[model samples]
Target: MGPSRLHLAQGALAALALGAAVLLQGQAPAASASSDNLTADRVENLRLGGDGVAQRRHMWTIFADMVSDEEPDFVHWQGESGVFGAEAAKRPSGIQGFQRPKSIGGDPHLIGAPIIAYNLFNPAAFAHIRAQGLYRKATLDRLQLTGGTGSVPPFPAAAIVIKTAWWPVAPEGLTAMPVWDPELNPPDPTGNPYLGWARVVAVDPTNISQGKTAAVQFVGRSFPGARRVQLEAFHHVAVDAAMAKQLAGDPESNRTAIIALGRPIAVNDQLALVGINVMTHEQQDWVWGAFWWHDRPEVGPFAADRPSTLPGPWRNYLMQAAFDAKTPRASDAGAHICFNPWLEARFPDGGQGGGTVSNCLSCHQRASYPAAPFLPVTRGAPNLREDPALAPDRLRTSFLWSLTLHAQRD
Candidate 1:
């Protein structure tokens, strides 16, 4: 598929921003979830009327509530071990546990390092798998080839999937850096890290269907083939600034570093809301949402007219949808959250480049199972449409590649 007209439209917007002499500066004031732009009333109205912005705002509200302990709660903490509190599946243990490689860095089988995921299906939608024992490889293979409603059954509205990472914890205000040891399939128990936060991607069928028309008009993109809309949210548990500083200074090394800097101070606090990524069928790319906490003085504010910058402390907490792929520039993009610049910096060619320009949708658009042989280490975007290996016939694992683990043999 050639670049859609939407791409061209985004380019035009970028041109306009570049040509302007007096660019907007400072940051837009933060808006409360109940504000006019993101009011609960507006969300309900948009849900009923089928507005894309409403869908984005509504999802943002839900995520905000999760982090802020707000009203109309839709998410809750389920703890570190196991899936939703159930003992983690032991059969698919070892390298076959979850297929997707670590989102940040390290080997696919390593623990402590961040891991990619697509397995989180809401109870209603996941019931299909449970009822039919689809978690089994044999059953999952059959379902992938000839099951579900559409090419992929729309995750029941509100169904959520997550990508999570753990931070090293220590008592004497010091801890060894977590390393990837392939030989240690599940990693030594003591070497394992604790949960830092989870990045949530959820399906909202109603909003997706409604957003189709609105996206084309507002964002210059359209997803006519979309059966369900998806939104992304982030949850973070703060760490000590001293630990963060140590980790930030030498994320690659520094397995053992101490007494080099300041006192230990808390960084992230509790399981708080970070940001949200909203999508419209019109723009295959999604919109990013972030909180003031991620904002920086140099980067202006989160989602401000000016391009945002990633400084100390907030460097690791990167948000997707930070820039509009159409414009492909930080100044033109909206305020969004994504992976920390440090993490993206580790993999320059990887989807998360260490720059003002990044798009969660664009990066994830390449998500696939039985990924091309050159995947994992291959930086840059994969040619899904042109590459025969990625052809739909060869098993396009929808957007969640981790789900492939269900059918993967140990």
Candidate 2:
């Protein structure tokens, strides 16, 4: 059957650094979110990634299904895996046992590099996938580019490619047909199984570039505890340096990227959003809250001044992920935690649209910018002169007060 009922907001808590201007927020010192909560330490420890041998066996044995250990309605997890792991489903291990493509690039079936994979319960095929698993692995409707891929360098943090899919299962290619079998589907999204919101995460055996077979973490979500629901989304996803500039207002706005999608959302009631690192650099991006969003799913008119929807603990976690200055530009690198107010949503979207506002520019420019997609140089890079101590993170010292909008003319 569909499983139990749950409600997850379509805008699954999204956050990215705004170049170096101040990602999570343009905060003040005291605004630093309490590291105590927000699963900070849990992320710091490397073991959370799980032992490779054991993990592989588990996925194969279970054949990947949407597994969930009930927490209070406030925190119904779809089942936990490594840092960037997804629920167990056919996504990770389809007909072929886990195998990576010879040529290193991206995946045509999923998002990210297929690092960590778990389960995605599709709805329409209730009779097919109901007995177990999150949702059936299938595609939803709409969109231009159906599939794409890229190479994921071995790094400590997990990387994920996200997209909002639809219609759980159809004839094969993208179609417009869905089925909701209440007797077997009420617990899930009727005929919805595994059609939307997933990550093609890259998992390394040794956490090194030359590691072994890269694994996948296919994850999906439904309102953790509440029934089913959907939200609209308007996102402008960008990365690295360009993202930083958008927040700093460096290019005065030209450096920004934008997009809009509308869809229904489900909220788990307890946890806001849960996934793994989509991209990693010298900086370790911790999940931060207290980001600003004008609304859900559908992003509103963005301007110079806007508040963040991200919460506090979530913000600090992202702010803490760091990078070593000496690391090579192209080689594996981690960034110190950074959250861009420029990216609106604070949670993950379950393959729909219209949840929060976002701008992912630097990611598009992955060709030129090195290190982190789009981060600000410590003020004075090639020519522009500025100071490092005055960095928004350094200045605010906290994630909360940092979110405040300021005027240069002052």
Candidate 3:
């Protein structure tokens, strides 16, 4: 698991490149899967076995448990409250209310739809941070060793963290349920797969105009009455107009798109959950999984072990997982690639010019107090044993970037 050179077959590399290309085009590839869907009893299995498919299925079980409505929505659990505004802090009842995503960062904005995001911590994660007083930058800096590689203790086995991306239906005031237009997305201009394959969604012009709703409209191909079906089912939260305006403020271009979509905004406007990144420290290296909304949820390796118990909108998401830096022994040994198209597709490697393949466990492994750059220093497969992004001088953050990036000064 430590830094070691990995030699992958040319064919496997090509497959990953092809997969990435298909995603950029905004079209999901056809499925070729085995019968690995999970059941209620299987949800308890957390071991990342040697088999890649089984490991991914194990991750799918974790995803199902996280999104289960039997418990409070992840948004209501607890946020990385040490950040600015403290708007995401938990309520007296222990339910952390929703907060507007501060920035789009490197995430991609979908056609006709601009993206927004927020992060939350499970009880175990939040408690560990609070108990250790790790929310303060000073605490992290002080923990850095005067000598030796300053690796901090890892979080407990039960700790979990989530970063969710959303589609903000705009106009600040428009709460009308919107429809999904299959044709509205721009066609893949570059027919060659390398440039990207499917058509990206089209931007809705009427929704972007400042304060004007002369004719609220969706610009792409029409999907009659399919309003909330494809993406409508995911859990959503209300965002007031004031906050919506603030989130849409920076990128003048996104300002409009953020306000136009259907759902909620401004007390009434609701944003749909488009994709999410889930990290569970169930194992030492930590098991990583990402889920993105897909019109066709029954295809691909990510869709392999989806359980029927995953209610409504949760079933619409397609997931991929990584239990190690290199592929599991059961699969062709290659750089494991798992990322949410909605979350990491736009950027090269999770961010900047990093690696050819994106690995969530690998990326988060670099989370350190002196804070390593979001982009991994190593190219291709990152060494899980000895991370280049994490130096001995810095304190590791147990793979939680929210702790490293969002923790504020006291």
Candidate 4:
């Protein structure tokens, strides 16, 4: 959408300034200081040798900024009320400080535990869409019909889109942390032993009412121990007594769990972030990265080059990044997979076998307005040849699925 409308003039001007700022940094050398310092050239020049050691460091800076930025949390940002519901729509301007998500919604596709996912937009991205009125179906439809050439309307270079996964915590879960070492449980060979187990809630799809707790899985890692000084290890949020009142809207439900909000834990309950997918529009194709929390964050190729300043539980994460769909071609022989287990691991069409082989940029490349099926190919290189989604001149969403999934009808 162009700035042809009088109403969007002011926003368009602001976007220009933001665009210049982003382009300036994007064209420059990778910043030595720790911020969102990923340059487009750095992403384009990435190599997969040594398991992408240098590439992982570049991606970690984005993660560091996302978790440690003094800005309001993604859930509290603008337009979340309409997209994720009121629980996520706490206005940022009025907020006193950085607040965590009020409630986390469950994803049925994910097999075990009460898993939650979030689609977040930074200020620059949200402001651009709001200015263009792209959130409305009518506007999107109009643009689809009349909007000029190009695959998609390019977003500001500073624009960021994030998808994060979280797991709710219970008091019993905290106390039940397993200390078993990997040497003892050789059969359970997916992840580390110190990472701890997550309480799995099994649900029958046909009968939502019928459900029960399943066997524990190697998914979560809990907070601190007996020592008073030991703070929580994960980037977590707690629904305290006051916030609980605001959410429930009932005096009696204040101290009780907000089960209706998809949070089974009580009023003061907490949830820890488990996985995240981050993307930036600084480049034309966009820079993509995925992260999953790990107890032994020190090990693995994904954990390479982590900055010392990454801060707190954020350091306890492993990362993988993909700059191009098929640059450093499949040396690992896993189809150049770059996916978060919590966010995409369960989808049957996620990859050739499943999420294990999925690539973020490849899947997101199919994001079009009329809504194309996001099918992931077995291999990372060579995207769908004759994409039915891109045919018939569909309005591309510039690799943002949120625009297709959550755009409102007015």
Question: Which scores better on lDDT, 3 or 4?
Answer: 4
* Winner by lDDT: 4
Span of ten consecutive residues with least summed lDDT in model 2: 401-410
lDDT of 3 by residue, 224-297 (tens): 33322322455655555555554444352244344445322344445666678888766666678888776557
| Cα lDDT tens digits for candidate 1, 218-336 | 01223233322112112333344543443344422232112111223234411222222323221212233332223222342323332122223333232333223232223334423
Find the 10 residues in a row with the least total lDDT in model 4: 222-231
Determine which window of 10 residues in candidate 1 has minimal summed lDDT: 194-203
Cα TM-score per model: 0.43, 0.18, 0.66, 0.66
* Residues 300-338 of candidate 2: C-alpha lDDT, one tens digit per residue: 211112214323222211111111111112111321112
Say which prediction, candidate 1 or candidate 4, comes out ahead on TM-score: 4
- Give candidate 4 misplaced runs (Cα > 4 Å): 1-38, 47-51, 69-76, 82-114, 171-231, 240-263, 331-334, 349-351, 376-378, 382-384
Residue range 1-410, candidate 4, lDDT tens digits: 23223324665543343334333433555334333334444455564343465566557656655665553256554534433332333444211112233322222332322234545677777767777766666767888888886345677767787766554455333222222222343322222212323222221122222223223332333222311111155666665655444434522232122321233435655545667788887577888898887656787677776766656777877888887666555545655667666655544543255555567877777778777656543455444457765665788878877666666665
Cand. 2 Cα-lDDT: 0.20
- Which candidate tops TM-score? 4
lDDT of each: 0.31, 0.20, 0.52, 0.53
Poorest 10 consecutive residues of model 3 by lDDT?
1-10
lDDT for model 3: 0.52
Q: In candidate 2, how many Å is residue 85 off?
A: 34
Of the candidates numbered 1 and 2, which has the greater TM-score value?
A: 1
Q: Provide the lDDT at 17 for model 4.
A: 36
